[model samples]
Every structure is written in structure tokens, then in C-alpha cells.
Target: MNETMRPVLGVSVAIWRGGRVLLVRRGREPFKDHWSLPGGRVEWGESLQDAVRREAAEETGLSLHTPHLVDTLDMIGAGEPPASHFVIVVFTADATGEPVAGDDAAEIGWFEPEAIAALPTTPDLARIVALSQRS
Candidate 1:
């Protein structure tokens, strides 16, 4: 079977610093050029917490800590035709550092809620960020 035929499990972090959150412009597909949270797939034998931290480090070079589960999303019908399905576990963590984009991120920046509202982003991204803040 093609890899896309299977469900993909991934982890994303809402790395918040004060009233702002970190977002990265994707360099790859599924949401290329769209601003989204910093995260990626969870490897085998890794805990959710570790996966969240590692993904943040790889994509944004930030050291995330105390990540707590916020929500899980079934994004099976997201994006354009031939869209890939992702069941992503979202976590919230606090980090402090000057983020430098790497991995699949094309660029990185910190944005307030109002700023994020104006960007092209993954479905439910704003909602996820809101939920992460409240949790």
C-alpha cells in the first residue's frame, strides 16, 4: 500500500512565550508555504512528550519544556485533492530562545493571536492555538 493510504500520527507544539506563539512557514506539502505550528511525525518508541520536544527542536531549534496535552485532531479530509490524513496530537509548552528555521520550516516568527488570524494556515490552527493557551 502507498504510505498515504495509512493514517499518520504526528505531534505538534504550541510554544508560547507570553501572549505570542511560534509559527513556521512550511517548506513542504500538505500545507506548503502556510504558517503552522512547529512539529512533525513521532518516531517509534518515543513518548509523546519527547516527540513534541524533538520536533520543536528540529524545526525551530527551541527547547520546549513541560508539554501538556491540549487536544487531538483527525485531519483526514484536510487540504486540496489527494490530501493526506493526519491524526495529530497537540501539546502546549513554554520556551524561550531566538528561533531559527530548519528542517521542513521555510521561515519562523512569533505571532500574536491577531497576527495569526491574518496568515494562511492549516485548518483548525487558530483554534488549536486558542485551546493550547487555555489548557
Candidate 2:
């Protein structure tokens, strides 16, 4: 099997404040330039919560706490043989400090749930936003 076919664990954090969620414009492939949550592939030996915190901080420059697991998404690339497959664990957390783009993020901003529909985003981002709202 090709290494790219192997499923990897990833984490995404929906850092919320004042009825809005933080979103980033991805600066890398697999969703380049698309609006998405702050997250990345989990490193070996890292706990889920730790990965979430690390990713959130790395991508958005904000501190997060008390992450509540919101959903798990199977992010499968669409192509003849598929480009990537990631099992993404999504969480909602309380965030501190203003967000600034860093790492794989091109831009970062807070967005209301209704505003999500106006942006180009990763697959299932709307659903993820809804799930975050319920949590």
C-alpha cells in the first residue's frame, strides 16, 4: 500500500468566543486557500487534547482550554486513487488572546455561523460549524 493511502490522525479545534468561531485560510494543500479550523496531523506520542492545543496555537496563535470533543470526520480526498485520507478529531474549546495567522494559516478571523456559507471551505465545514455550535 502506498504511504499516502494510510489514514493519519489529525485534530481540529473550534475556538469559540462571543458566538463566533475562529477559522483560518489554509496555506497548504489538501485544502489550500480554503477556510477551515485550526489543526494538523497529530504527532506520534501526542495525546488528542495536547495535539488540539498545539495545533490551535500553531495555526492561530491563540491559547485554548477545556476542549470538548465535538465530532470525528473522515476526510478523504477525491481523485482517481484519492490524494489523502485523515481521521480528524474535532473539538470545541474556550480561547484566549486575539488570533493571528501563523504556520499553515494564510489568514485568520472570527466568523459567525451564518457567515460560513459565504466562504469557500473544506468539506463538511458547515456541518462541523453546526456541531461546534451545539457543543
Question: lDDT winner among the candidates?
Answer: 2
For model 1, residues 19-129, the per-residue Cα lDDT tens digits are 898899999987899999998998999998999999999999888869889999977764545367889999988886779999999999989977888899988999999
TM-score of each: 0.89, 0.94
Q: Count the backbone clashes (under 3 Å) in each candidate.
A: 0, 0
- Looking at candidate 1, what is the lDDT of residue 121? 95
In candidate 1, stretches whose alpha carbon ends up further than 4 angstroms from where it belongs are 1-4, 78-82
Give lDDT: candidate 1, residue 69.
Answer: 93
